[model samples]
Target: MKTAITAVSGQLGRAIANRLITETGKDNLIGIARTPPKANDIGIEIRKADYNNRKDFDEALKGIECLLLISSMDHPQNRIPQHRNIIEAAKARGVKKIVYTSIVGDPEKNGFSPVVKSNRQTEEDIKKSGIDWVIGRNGLYIDPDLEYIDQYIADGAIINSAGDGLCTYTSRGELAEAYAHLLTQEVHNGKTYHLVGNPISQAQLAKYINDAFNTQLTYKAISVEDFRNNRIKDLGQLVGTIIGGIYEGIREGAFNLKSDFEKAAQRPHKSVPEMIEAYKQFRD
Candidate 1:
């Protein structure tokens, strides 16, 4: 079966495409990216297909049996149409099945709600597109904490608005591995799985980082308003507001959902500490 992965130049897309290659071989994989040259080194057929251009996808998705639709990072209001273009193109190209990577969060009452709602809309669109489907609602990612290690070390704390909230934080690598299975296997069709891993509080995350990097960082809970304003100051309005909204969702227990990761991936998700340790070794 020919499997095509959209947004193949991105970090998550690269991870998923590379992992799938190990199982399905390079010849069976086609990568759809907005820019093909950046990902030409990925060892697969790279097709240039922008989200806004259905004509690009029409030609790119030809002969593809399965598609892995990675959610877009565009503004929430704009994401739905962009995703639909890909979905419509995939359908037109006679793609038989599609696996979508979606997010799990509140669909209303948070700044991130719009993004969640858009993902839900795309999921519905995929379902109605007359193709067999699998949907994986991914958990909050844990990689940001590792990525912010330097800032945390300097500040002496991992500061956020999620006070004592247990987050089902899975990594991009873990999610990518799960998608590899979901995209290839016929059994995952017509199913929606919560592909999240073990839950860990922000304090526990700090502890794991401590264990991995021997950092003395601690967890500091701030008010949502304060965190939001701070992020807005640093990241500008568009991205900062989204970051604040994610924490707001976490504070409201929206991210504390049950996971079906093992069922989807057919393997136990890696523990937080184990992944941190592995990340440390990989970087060192």
Candidate 2:
């Protein structure tokens, strides 16, 4: 079973590729990225493929039996077209199956609607392409906590607009492992799996952080405007707008959906406390 992973230079892609190498073999895996040198170094066949270039995708997808279409990191306007190009290329190449990484929510209803909109469109296209497909609607990742930890500690609080909103946070590594299992098993075809861990409110998350670092911290619920302003002050407007939309999505109950993550992983999924504990070493 010859398999290809798009965006192999990315963290999730790299994790999935590494797992595939262990499960199948390096010889059967192809790593597609805009820059192929890093993937090449990993001993997988490297192919230069850019989501923006149809020819690049076409050439890279050739001879692959299955493809993992990692969503493009571009803005929504640019991302949908790029996904379309890849889906067309995969269809033309006679690829047997495709597994797409999607977001956990109804695009039309989510606070971050544009992102989920693009993902939904791409999913629809994949289904219409007549290729066997699996959609992994991944939950919000806990990794972002690492980036915001310093601020949280300094402020003695984790501030957000999501008031009592619960999010099922899964680690990127766990999500990648689920993708690997989905790719290796034929039974997963045509199914949409929600790859998420147990849900925890931001208040609970704050408690976990406090416990891990031995500090007194709180979860402060702020207005959307206040949160946006604070984020803008800290990270500029554009990034602030993007992140604000994520919290808005949480507030709208987008990330509250349940999942079969344990079943998909063939083991228990990591909890928020466990994830926080692992990061305790960086707390001092």
Candidate 3:
């Protein structure tokens, strides 16, 4: 069976493409990216496809049996339209199955509802498309923590407005592995999988950091206003607003779902503390 992975040049996309290549061989896989040249190093057939351009996606999707539709990072308002184009193209090209990367939690009820509204719409569209499909509602990734590790270690504290909220964090690599497994099996068709790891509170996350790096870092729950102010000072208003929304979602128990990662990948998912040990630079 032939398969194509969209946005193959991106971090999660590239990881999923690599896993697909290893499992199904390079000949059976196609890497679709806005810039096809960027995926040349992936050692597979590369096709130029853009989510915004229906023509680009239609031509690239021809003859593919299964298509992995990686969600667009554009504004929420634009995402559903972009996804519709891909879904339409998949139907036109006779693609048998579509696998979508979606966010965990109910968009209608979550604090981060605005961010995931488009995802819910896309899911509904996919279901109505009359194609065999799998929706992987991926958990929040823990990799972002690496970017702020230095500051967190230096400050000896991890501050947020999560306030006893829990999040199930999984690594991108493992999530990719699980996706690869799902794509190869026909049994998973029409199933929605929650691809997540263990759920832990902000305080438990802080403890993991302290234990992993041997630092005296503490989890400090601050008010939303204070958290937004601090994040704005460091990361600008746009990012601060985004982070604030995520924290609000956490507080509302949006990302606290039980995951099927182990069942999907047939292995134990990595925990936060385990990930810290795997990446030694966090200790440095």
Instruction: For model 2, state the Cα shift of residue 223 in Å.
Output: 0.6
| lDDT of candidate 2 over 179-222, digit per residue (tens) | 99989899889988889989888899888877777878899899
Candidate 2 vs 3: which has more lDDT: 3
Reference-based lDDT, residue 57, model 1: 91
lDDT for each residue of candidate 3 in 1-284, tens digit (9 for 90 to 100): 89999999998999998888778788889999999888899998999988999999889998999999999988778899999999999999999999999988657653356668889899999999999999999988888875688889888788889899999988778888999988888888988889998989998988887787687888888887787777778877666666777887787788899888877888989888887676665346
lDDT of 1: 0.91
Q: lDDT at 151 for candidate 2?
A: 84
- TM-score, candidate number 2: 0.93
Residues 216-255, model 1: lDDT tens digits? 9889999999999999999999899999999989889899
Ranked candidates, highest lDDT first: 1, 3, 2
Alpha carbon lDDT at 162, candidate 3: 86
Where is the poorest 10-residue window by lDDT in model 2?
A: 275-284
- After best superposition, candidate 1 residue 21: deviation in angstroms? 0.9
Flag regions of model 2 displaced more than 4 Å.
109-111, 233-237, 278-284
lDDT of model 1 at residue 126?
A: 94
Lowest lDDT sum, 10 consecutive residues, model 3, at 106-115
* Model 3 misplaced stretches (Cα beyond 4 Å): 109-111, 232-238, 281-284
